[model samples]
Target: MRKKRGIVKRRETGIKYEISRKNLHYEKALDEIIRIFETENYRDRTINDYRRNWREFFKIIGKENVFDVTREDFRKYIRQRMQMDGLAAGTVNIRLGGVKSIFSRLVKEGILTENPGKDIPKLRTDEKPIFAFSDRQLKRLFSIIDKTSVAGYRDYVAMITMLYCGLRANEIENLEISDIDFDNSVIMLPGSKNKNRKIRAVPMNRKVREELRQLIIENQENFGEDVTHVFLTTFGEPIHHGLIRKRMHKYGKDAGLIDEARVSPHSLRHTFAIRYLKNGGDIRTLQMILGHSDITTTQVYLRYNNDDIIEQYNKATENDDLNL
Candidate 1:
């Protein structure tokens, strides 16, 4: 049997423990998030981007307690970004991921029992299509590069390496001169530089091999054997990913190729993969060369439009005989 005592009075402000939980008032919530990200040793760029996105989200929703934040709040932030700012779906989606990751961390730490942004679907993004440059466009792009000078030669080699090796922008930036094995004609990418944190070797064809050799000779003669990076800037400093992108854009603009296709490092990589597959390279082998951690990611390159499908179908069935 339970004993009944005098009725307890409730505070008009809030419940007892709720006072302590008020620290999750979004301002402190962001502070806790920064600490957690730092403790996890996230990259500076990643941390900065996450912080920016959080501020953007809170600015949109007008900063309430994290405890009071609901899924609809997340939806409202996304809607405002799409409607008012006219941001691309992909851009908004990336920022949404940044915002959601904070809620996830809070849930993991027992600060919140449920993640508010857990089931928020990404915005549909079918406005523009990604594509690779045709052989003629690539040839025109190559012809425009001024390979006589050091900077021009550097750009030329960089573009060719991406076409032949199918490397990402960061991978190109991180390529060390020592990673190139002239004897075996292989370029070894260390785990630290790879997105998946896995070591992989990319084989060099005869063309890639000879071009890399020339670049090395020029690099050594000018900067000496002490310089470790495979590519350098016009000022003899380390290459940056932004500079590479801008150079690709410049090359595209100069060659009048930007009108037909998007010009970037990834496009060169896509060109490499499509050519590799069209030349009869198997999916499994292509996966290894591109350093993809999952086969499904590599399989996306296998997708073809209706026109391409019909062409390939006619070619394949054209030779087959139904003799049975």
Candidate 2:
């Protein structure tokens, strides 16, 4: 007869095991997950995030086994995360996605009988990411920099690269002199966030080309050697991200353009996309130039097509003899 408490089951094969209702399935599931990610060659950063999430989950489960974990555990995790200071809904969703991915991998590996995170829904929150700057704001930012100063020249170049070419912060920072082709007026970004390898060509607008050319000339004349990047601090080092943001904010404040809005280096890329689309650039072309993996991603800029809306409105309201 099975005992009501402190029970141990022994098999004829001399194998003894304790079968508790606690969740043990998660243990095998986590190991299988690591193997699956290793096989798939997920990015290092992604794998690190999974490991961190697994740690948090293991801590929460304590002595509980994986199979015994319920949807409630995940819900409670969400609540706990929400209670944390400075936790954004979007960020939470990403972590939740990592958790879900672990279970999914477990299911695929035949480790877990079922996926617990599958049924878990995302939390709702009202926070839209603030992106890009307006054309007027971009102009104001440029106006505050002194064209002759090293910092000013670096910033101007950075702005042009970010705004006109739509390069990411890292891409701009990593850019080498060899990345640019002065004759071709193009740049080759080896790879980026989406891991897409392609070259980007920006037909340097007259103003931007002139600014770059002048900077190059001045550097050669003053330093007796050519600089590596289109932008560099006075110390010939790459500008720090925080310094760039600070300078942008300072300029924004100086231009009296401060507002209840969030802005960053990414704003240049966003503003570029909008202006390009509004000027009738094709989605496919924009995708190639911006190194976008999908056309849908570039479509985010299409949402800001105020020019098209106004043209349509004008067309709808136009009447030659309305006054008569």
Candidate 3:
């Protein structure tokens, strides 16, 4: 039995009627929002994120109806996430994005007349410098990797792929033998594997090509030609993200490089970007190679060091000497 909108449900007690205290619309609205997300082709992890955020919002809002939630309530929730939960603004924004989507969806569906989350402002984020490994640091890091063994070599190839090709962790994790174009000297990332969900071909350098080809051949010989994925564990199973991260972290530690820099998949990608720019590659080309949707992301590599600035300054003023 459903009560009309704006009419409170009541339970009879002899001659008296008491209004029901429960929120009537939360579950239904949540389900509808989830269905909408699915229809929109949102990834499973992303949909689950939205569900988690929505449930948390409901819990912290304290039995209030979804329709009655105010802008102040949203602000309070953000404050609690920041102060009590100790989340960074970037992380808070990622979670808040789900809630904001839900509010907008509700308003569009006529479930709400006005969206409280519409005017909710984004939090300011601090800019952090890109952490890229230096050439000496990379050589030091690579020296400790025991490439004589099968698994060791596989790990080596994986890291090399990231450093030279600039593949993201997820893309590398999902990489398959079919994705490699040996003759073309490029790695093809299907839309499913890429962050932007667009098919991208990343040209591989000579080192990447040789290493990847050797790894693929070794994988076929050891794990059987039926194995589809490019990288594999010693047990012949597909390599997972955690294993890759752990191995890279240990290598970073073994090389004593953790004190000054990060040694992870992202750092490898960053190192590739910095190295590419230093080698005189254009930013636009780097953007395409790295599969960045925004050119602005590639521009960050343009921020040069003091030594680079001085060298360029001296070169530009080469003919204008003060010697008399």
Q: Give one digit per residue, the lDDT tens place, for model 3 in 1-324.
A: 986555432222111112243343566677777887788899888888888988888787674477678899889889989999899998888888888888888777655668788898999999777888878999999999999999899889999999998998888888998999999998989888888889999999898999988998998999898999988988889987678889999999999998998888899998888888888899999999899999998898889443477899999999896887
TM-score of 1: 0.85
TM of each candidate vs. truth: 0.85, 0.74, 0.88
Instruction: Give the range where candidate 1 is weakest over 10 consecutive residues by summed lDDT.
Output: 8-17
**Residue-level error in angstroms, candidate 3, position 183:** 0.7
User: Each candidate's lDDT (Cα)?
Assistant: 0.82, 0.69, 0.83
Q: Candidate 2 regions off by >4 Å? A: 1-41, 56-68, 83-88, 123-132, 192-203, 213-229, 318-324
Candidate 1 — which pairs collide?
none
Q: What's the CA error at residue 310 for candidate 2, in Å?
A: 3.9
* Residue lDDT tens for model 1, 123-213: 8887455488888899998888999989898889889999998988888888888889989999999887877778999999898889888
Model 3 TM-score is 0.88
For model 3, what is the error of residue 166's alpha carbon versus the real structure, in angstroms, after optimal superposition?
0.6
Candidate 2 Cα deviation (angstroms), residue 77 = 2.2
Q: Judge candidate 2 against the unseen true structure and give its global Cα lDDT, from 0 to 1.
A: 0.69
